[model samples]
Target: MHIPELYCPIPSSVVVKDPEAGEELIRWGADQGFFSLDSDAANLVRAIDIPLWTALAHPMLKSADDRSFLNRWWTWGAVFEMRFDTNAGQELDGFFEKFMDSTARTQIRILSNNPPLRDGEDFSEPMDRTLVSLLRETEQRFGNPWRSRISRSLLASAESGVWEARANYLSQTPDFDLYQGLRRHSYGQTYITDCAMMAMGIDAEAKFLRHPVIEHIQYLVALYGGFVNDLNSLDRDLYANNRCSSVIAYRHQYGVTLDEAIRAVVDMCNGYLRSVLAIEAAMPDYGKYSFDDQEADQIDSFFYILKMLMRGNIDWYEVSPRYNGGWKPGGPIDPAPWG
Candidate 1:
């Protein structure tokens, strides 16, 4: 049984700019509980680590590496996930509410008969002023149509994760199709397209994303990602009272032992990986237009990035202590297998 190999050589250009970016991202992932060894860490780390990894691994061209979009998205994605565990609506609500409260307080001070003089006196504290300014700046930034577009895109992605999480928590029986669908969106697979486009150029994402074949390939990529996660976190998932796993779900559905369940998922993931490679190999037939050398290079780069993600995920999972150290394999079957 042959399996596709995985490895991503760091591009020299990326290394030149940020020599340690890849290593740092890997270390950050390990510490943030993506590894089995770090099982004691908060599960909420998923919100942070996944987005950050995606952002860090974004295949922006050398020229665009300095753009803040990736980092900004990573920050907001983490915040969104944290809010999911606590209160999803509160962060947005609180952002506005805090600003309004501060404004009202400032207005009241101005309307009152308070003296404007006094050496150490101020209408608002320094920290309050900073907060207000930040709020104003954030409002102004969002007013930009480009930022607004990305914000909407990210919000949609976050909503998918929220839905999938809910579904996983509620489901007891294994529904492979449902799991794949939810996993693709929940794991931020669509963002791979976005990142690839960013790497290619301004409209590159739009042009390539419009192709029906590319959409099909992207779906496979998402499945590969999700299954890799399912395999890596088998132990952690069981420990965390999580049954939203393909392996356990399969075992429940088929009444198979843990080892059999693992084998089935590995086969499923391998099939998806093979599909991705086949798409890469058949790019000429599927591409919407003929490309000159430059355009061809761009397309090749896009696929390379996608493969990098596929391989990078497996590498991260193997090395990360959060997935490896803490849990034992083949524990007692969880009685409630739906979750």
Candidate 2:
């Protein structure tokens, strides 16, 4: 689904000026049926510009020696940029800075609040300091001083209570078993972390959707998206991370091969797509200017683009890889049955 041309009637001009006020406005918009929780979630997801930019900016990830990986990363950024609202793009630069700072502060506080898990152990202090320093260094390297500041503040504020809640949620529920599985899988861990951060951003911004139901939906979408991307990059992820994805983990435990594993992952992703489609359909009708239609179209366009890429009809530079890793165009292959 290519992103639809529908303009979100909610004024970007007003929202972009102040994030707190913008969040309130988003909630109001949702209540009035001008938007859905998913759309609001999408906006929060878009705000994590740093991670996306990091994937683009990091030399290790974007080596000129590996043109395919660099090109694919660029393509992914382009697609996201194409779909992102212009105002949202402008707001994100600042929002990302504040967000990073917030997360950094929170991480620091959490580390300080927790005691060592073992005798004569005190890795938390040094690890927290190292992460803070790394965050600063990353921002400096990227020329984002504000991001560094915000990251420091964010991590400092994230204390034991928050950590405990997150830990409890991950440990206590079958609902979050997929997340735990992802955490256990090396390649899948990035998705879990990214989704957790995205969910936090949404909660921090729009307070109304902080409920478990909303968080669970966001987690599901993120997990399934990760599954799809992992299936698409199975060979690359294995080579780069020396670990298979959660889907592969499940397969190994149950005894399945590459092809069978791919099918299972695809089926799971398709189920997520169906759920997304249903949510988009249920959104209140907004005459000819429907946000639901716009969302549905974007989903359709993404699948269409995936189809084209699978068929090798799209230029390698035109379709981007969603996750980090190197790629070799037409290296070793299985002809996709979807083609």
Misplaced by over 4 Å in model 2 are 1-180, 183-207, 237-241, 283-339
Candidate 1 — worst ten consecutive residues by lDDT sum?
330-339
Residue 317, model 1: lDDT of 56
lDDT of 2 by residue, 119-159 (tens): 33333433343334433443454334333333433332232
Top model number, lDDT: 1
lDDT tens per residue, model 1, 1-339? 222333234331122224344344334434433334333222334322433344335534445333343533343333333323311212443443363355434422322314332343444443323323322343354333333334334444555555544543444444665666666655445554454455345343345555677677777877677677777666656555555677777777778888887888888878777777887877787554534444666678767777766765665554433353433434222111112
lDDT of each: 0.49, 0.34
How many steric overlaps are in each model, in order? 12, 20
Assess candidate 2 and give its lDDT.
0.34
